[model samples]
Target chain A: MIHFFNDIARTRLTRWVFGWLFLVLLYQWSANLMISQLESPVLLRVDLDLTYWLVHLTGIGEFFRSSYFAAFSFDFFLTVLCLVAVLFPKRTIVPILTGLFFLIYCVLLNSYQCWHYHNLITLILLIVPFCFRSLKTFSILFAGLRYAVAYIYASAAIWKLVRGSVFNEGQMKWLIQHNYVDRLAVEGYELNFLENMMFQLSNYSTLSSIALIIGVAMEASFLIAFFTRKFDRHLIIIGVVFHLITAVLVDVSFLQLWILFLVFLPPDRITSSPTTWFQRQKA
Target chain B: MNFFLRDVWKQSKIVFAFFVAFILGTIWCTFSKIEITPFFLWAHYSDKQTPTGKFERIYIKVNGEILDLPKFSRATREMIQLPTEYFVQLERTDYNTNTRQLIQKKFASMMSQKSLQKMEGHLCNSKEDKNAYLYWMAKYIERVTGKRVLTLEVGTCELLFKPDGTVARENFIFVAKFSRA
Candidate 1:
C-alpha cells in the first residue's frame, strides 16, 4: 500500500492536483485569518469550537480551556503547514498531516456552527493522498470530485424551481429590493450595474423571463458532463461567466466555486501547456 | 508491497457506487422535502423574494456616541460578512435583551423629544432578557475602539418609496441598544 501510494504521488498529475488544492486552501485560509484579525474581537475571542467541547466532555473541561486566540493560532498554523506540505510533497507524510490538521479545523468550525457546504471541498483534499494510491482509486476519486461539482449546481437549480416564483419579474424585484438594496443601504453604498439592470428589467416580464431561463440553464449546464466529457470546457466557461455576472450584480462572490471548477480541467492539459509552448519556442 | 491492480479496480467500483448513491440521495431529498442531517449542501436556494424600492439605513452606537455603520464602516462590513440570514437573525435575537433595552433607553435620552416621538416601533419595551448580546457588543466595541464600552445603541433610518419614485425619508429612529452587564 505504501509503495503504491508513493509511486502515484510521484506522478506529475498528482503533484499538480495537490498544488491546486494547496492554492485553494492558502487563499481561503489567509483571507479568513486576515479578516478575523481586523474585525471586532468582542465575542469572537470567546467563541468556542468542538475541541473545547471535547475537552469538556472528557471531564477535563476545566483544564482544556480555549479562547479565540487558541482557535486563531491553530488555524494559522494549519494554513502554513498546508502550504509547506504542498511545497515539500517528497515528505509524503507531510501532506497527510496537512489533511488531518484541516479535518480538525473543520470540526472546530462546525462546533461554532460556522461550517458551510463549500468546506466539503477540503474533504476531497483530505482524501487525495489516500485515493492516489493506485490507478483505479485515482479514477474513482477524480470522477467523484466532478460529480460533487455537478451536484452543487443541479441541487441549486432544483431548489430554485421548487420555489416556483424565481422566474417571475416580481421575484427579481423582490430580490433586488429586499436583499441587495437593504444590504447596500446598511453599508451606505449605491446601486451597481446588476441592481440597476434588475430594476429596469423588473417590470419587463419577457426580459426577466429570458434572464431567469439563462440562469437556470447555466447552473444546470454541468449535468451534460454526466452524459459525456465532450463539452467540459464550454460548461466551465459558462459557469465562470454566470458566477462573474452574479458577482457584479449582487455582492455575493463565488470565487471559491471558480477554484472548485478547476477539477473539470484535466491536470495534464494545464501542466502540458507551458511545456509545449516552451518546446515550440525552442524549435 | 505492490498489490494487484485488479483488487484496486474492484474496490474502486464499490466507491463509485457509493458516490452515485450519495449524489442521487441528495437530489431526491431536495424534491421530497425530507429532513437531511448536517445540511452541508443547501446551495443557497432560499427564496430571496422581498419587496424592493424602499431605502433603509441601519446605525450602531457604542457608549453614548453613534458610530459610522454604513458599508464603509469596518464594524458593519464585518458583521455583514456573515451569511445574510445569519446576520439578520443575530440582530433579531440580540436586540430583544435587557442590556440592549438599557442601550435603547440611553439612545432615547440622547434624542430630542420630537425625534423620539417621530421614532416608530418599540425600540426596547422595558423587557429583561439575557445579556449575551450586550456582552458580545461590548467586547466587539472594546476591540474596535480600543476602549471598554459602557453602553451601546442601534437605530434605523428608513425611507418609504412612493410609486412615482419619490421617497419619504425618516430620520434616525432607535432600534436596539447594548450595555455592559
Candidate 2:
C-alpha cells in the first residue's frame, strides 16, 4: 500500500499547491518579521533587538547574536547569488533553503518571548535540510528549528481553539467590526476596501458565521499543511490572503512571517488523489 | 582582579568573551523603533485642518508587482501588541532623487488615489483600470518631491519619523513588493 502510494495526482497536486510558497515565500517572511521586530518596543524602543538584548543577556547572544543577523544576511545573500550562479541547482538551492530556515529559528528565539507564528515558520523551514544526508550542519539546525516551529504551531493553534477565540463567531465578528466601520476606511488608510467588505458582510450574522468557519478551516488546514506540502501550499495562499485582508482591514501585519514555510517542499505535489488513490486502495 | 579573571577563565572563556561583546553591542550603540506614529500624528492633525491629508496607506504596482504600505492606524501605541511594523517594498533611487520621473509620478498618484481607497484598503481593487491611475501616482509624488525626473527601481513605503524616533505610523500594514536588482 505504501509503495503504491506514489502517483502523479498526488505529486501534481502537491506541486501545484505549494510551488510559489516554498520558493518565493521565505525571504518575504523573514524580511517581514525582522523588519517588524526592528520596529518593536524591544528593538526600536529600547535600541536592542532580540540578539542584542535577549540572547546576549541570557547566553547565546554573547558571541553569535549581535553581528549574527548582518553576517547571516550577507551569507544568505551570497548563497542566493551562488544559486543564481549555478542556474538554480537543487543541490545548491536545497542547502540554502534549509539554512535560511535554521537562521529564522535562531532569530525568533532571540527576539520574542512567545512561540508565535514567526517561530513556527522558522521551524518548518528547516525540514528539507534535515532530510539531506551530506549536509550535517544544515540537517542538525533544520531538525532543531523544524521541531520548534511545529511545536509552536500546534500548541498555539490548540490554545486559540480551546480559548473559544479562534472558533468563536462573535469574536471573529468583533475582530471584523473592530477592524471595520468608520475607523477602517478612516481617511483612506490601508485595507479600506477589505474593511468595506467586512462591513458589508458583517451586517448578517449568518455570513459572519461563515467567515468564522473559514477561520476555523484556515487554522485547522494549517496543521494539515505542516504534515503534507500540498495542504501547506494551498493554505499558505489562503492564510496570506486572509491576513492581507485582515491587515488591510484591521491592521495586522505578519502575513509573510506567518506563511514562511511555503518556501520549501514541492508545494504542488500531492500525497494522493482522493478518487484514484481511494479506488486503487479499495480495489 | 586575579580571582575574577580566573573565574572568567573557568566558564567557557570563548563563550564569556562573546557574551561581553553582545552586551557592549546592545548597550553602547542605539537603534530606533520606527513606525508611522508620527505620520499618524500628522494625518490626524492635518485631517482636522486640511481635510484631505490624513495619514494613509495606498496600494500600487511597480512594473507588475502589487504593493500595499499601510501608514495609518487607530490604536494607540500602549494598547497594541506584537510588531506592527511592516516589511514593505523598499524605495530606490538614492534617498530622495532629484531626477526620477517615473518615481515622482507614481508617488503623486499614490498620494492622490490614497484618498479614493480606504485607509489601507485592498491593494489592487481594480487591476484593469490601473495604468492611468499609477502613472498619475508617480506623477504626483514626483511633483511633490522635486523637479528633475529619475528612472527608478525600488519598493518602499512612506516612513514618518518622530523627532525622537520612538513610534512610527501605528495601526497600519506595511506593503509587500518584490524588488528586482
The number of the candidate with the highest DockQ is 1
Report how closely model 1 matches the true complex, as a DockQ value.
Answer: 0.13
lDDT over C-alpha atoms for residue A250 of model 1 = 45
Output the worst ten-in-a-row residue range by lDDT, candidate 2 chain A. Answer: A39-48
For candidate 1, the per-residue lDDT at B140 reads 49
Specify the highest-lDDT model's number.
Answer: 1
Model 2 segments beyond 4 Å from truth?
A: A1-120, A123-131, A134-157, A166-169, A180-194, A221-283, B1-69, B72-181
List candidate 1 stretches off by more than 4 Å: A1-65, A90-95, A103-132, A183-205, A270-273, A277-283, B1-14, B24-39, B46-59, B63-130, B141-150, B154-176
DockQ for every prediction shown: 0.13, 0.02
lDDT string, candidate 1, B8-72, tens digits: 34566676565556656666666555423222344463474555566565556667865543333
**TM-score of the B chain in each candidate versus the native B chain:** 0.46, 0.23
**Using alpha carbons, what is the TM-score of model 1?**
0.67
Residue B167 lDDT in candidate 2: 19
In candidate 1, residue B43 scores what lDDT? 44
Per-prediction share of native contacts kept: 0.18, 0.00
Model 1 chain A poorest ten-residue lDDT run: A40-49
